[model samples]
Target: MTPERREEPGRRKALAFTVLVHAGLIAALFLGVQWKRSQPDVVEVELWSSRPTPAMQPAPPPPPPEPEVKPEPKPEPKVEPPPPATPEIAIKEDKKKPEPKKPEPKPEPKPEPKKPEPKPEPKKPEPKPEAKTQPAPDFSEMLKRESSERTARTNAASAQQLANAARAESELRAAADKKGMQDYAAKIRGKVRGNIVLPQSIQGNPEAVFEVIQLPSGEVLSVTLKRSSGNPGLDAAIERAILKSSPLPKPDNPALYQRTLEIRYRPFEE
Candidate 1:
């Protein structure tokens, strides 16, 4: 019995060791499955699209297509129907001749009468009447007073002639001055017109006014636009033109020369 008991104890110990080993293996396998379930799964995928996003450096938007310029269509010429031909008609008329009248005779010239010779007159007797005044009226004094009166009349006539001559001279000078002023103004206008370069798109007679200052030598000192023509380009062009005409036309008469000029610029005919 002691021998059997010892064998039984050894078998039980072996079986117990085998059972503990199998239980440890089962515990390790369950922990590995739990760890695997807790861990996160990582997946990688690639995305593609036909169009590029802003984020992606989109190729510089194909250079914006250049705008095409079309030639302006030319206007067709108008055709007018010719007038119908007119038929010619001929007409004949007869002319009448008148008879001539007789001419009248001219009167004859009469002869002039001659003057008669003078006859001698009878001699008459002279009467001696010596009626001498107490004092011969002062004849010398009378002659002197008459001479003074004549001198005064001659002086007055001379004064009147001088006044008439002065008035005529003044009138002639004024007329000449006015003509000179007109001519000077015309010359200035012409000079400005010659230098002006009009814009192609301008329409209507839009006016641009300027106040200009100049030197006596016809040099343009300054040009200030007083009014605009509404078209900035046109106004700018004219302003440039005025400056380009640096030395303007000088007046024929220096007295007609002016320092300032108010010029009105018109695009069309002056």
Candidate 2:
């Protein structure tokens, strides 16, 4: 059949469905209006009283009248009929056209045969030179030389170790002797310093140097002034203090004893 004739049936079905929907809407609106009008009106009231006082007796003569209310009629709900069933129209589909046939692929050419590779020539081996025969070494002579060399090295190392030990011993002894002498001199100075009486005329700080001779028993033999303090009175005081300090402290080590000693003194030695 023609396409125009096929479309005519679909159009008629659409028109019928639209008319039925309009009729349903109108019926719903009319029912809603009627229900609102039939509903009863409500009234609310509130009562208030003053503060309570003492109870008073009175004559019972009046009664409260009853309130008169009119009865309201209930609205009857309208029943809605079920909507008509929609008609399902049969849709006619057009036939599909046949697809064109694809062209066949051509066969690939066969690969050429591979040629055989030529082989390399084998190399000739060269003649080896004859080895010369050597005489065997004398193991006894070699061992004798090695033993002598080891003995010489051991002797040299021993001598060096002994020399180093001797040198270290001497250095330690010298240091101890020096320390003993310094402590002895300090003790002597302490004694002399305590006996010294400063002269009133001695103004600035002055340094004096004195050379003292002592016996091994620590007895002062004599005292000679090497550098003066530039003041005669101060010099006399220092000399008297030194003389009073006779029999000074002796050295702890006898090797640290000296016949003559150079003593330096400052008036204000902090």
Candidate 3:
């Protein structure tokens, strides 16, 4: 059979199946025509295309910076050694010169004692006036009393003289008398006389006294007082009169002569 063109339904079916198959295979083998229809559009970026550009070209990382080493602080400038201390000069001990001993203090002079002021002498007491004394009454009464005593004394002496002279020879008696006479003349000195000063109150008293000085030859010397004047003037005159009458008669016996020669002057009872 050449296959007479006949139409079988099955075969048509078979033919349709074959055509669909071939067409499906042809559609799957498309030549780059992308026929995309109704799926939503989607965009996808590649990772390598979106990288950012750097602002500066980075240097390869430098070797790690060296760690800063701090240098130790320099030691403070060394202090210069102080100049060697000057050695204390040991001066040789000077021989101890002893200080001269202080001069001994001069002793102060003693102050002169002050003189005492002269005190006024007390005035002497004036003498008081003395009361007058009364003169003796009746000068002759005193004279007579004194004369009586005198005369008796003379008489006794006269007796003694006679007795003593009686034993001597006449030549011896004469020689003694002459010797006494010679002494009597020599007793007077200085002008013609000497006067015995008697108090005026006693001019009238007849009490008598005599001076009988012995010569070198032991002879009785002289006598002259007498009683003749009544006035004091005349009585005073009589005292002078006696000294002026130097020599007088001599006695034979020396004892009688010496004992009696104090011639008493009776000047008050004329």
* Best-fitting candidate, scored by TM-score: 2
Tens-digit lDDT track for model 3 on 194-220?
333334454344422234344444344
TM-score of 1: 0.44
Q: Write the per-residue lDDT of candidate 1 for residues 1-270, one digit (tens) a residue.
A: 889887997889989999999999999889766734331111111011101122123223221211111121111111211100000000000000000000010111111011111100100111111123325455644564466556555545554555555556555655565466567666666666666666677777676666578899878899886557778888887778778877878878885555766566677653
Error of 2 at 169 (Å): 2.3
**Candidate 1 clashing pairs?**
none
Higher-TM-score candidate of 1 and 2: 2
Candidate 3 has what TM-score?
Answer: 0.18
Question: Would you list the C-alpha lDDT of every candidate in the order shown?
Answer: 0.48, 0.46, 0.32
The candidate 2 region of ten consecutive residues with least summed lDDT is 85-94
Off by over 4 Å in 2: 1-144
Screening candidate 2 with a backbone cut-off below 3 angstroms (N, C-alpha, C), the clashing residue pairs are: none
Count of steric clashes across candidates, in order = 0, 0, 5
Candidate 3: pairs in clash = 143-206, 209-262, 210-262, 210-263, 227-266
Which residue runs of candidate 3 sit more than 4 Å off their true CA positions?
1-169, 185-226, 240-257, 262-270
Model 1: residues with Cα > 4 Å off, grouped in runs:
1-148
Sorted by lDDT, highest first, which candidate order results?
A: 1, 2, 3
> Candidate 1 — what's its lDDT?
0.48
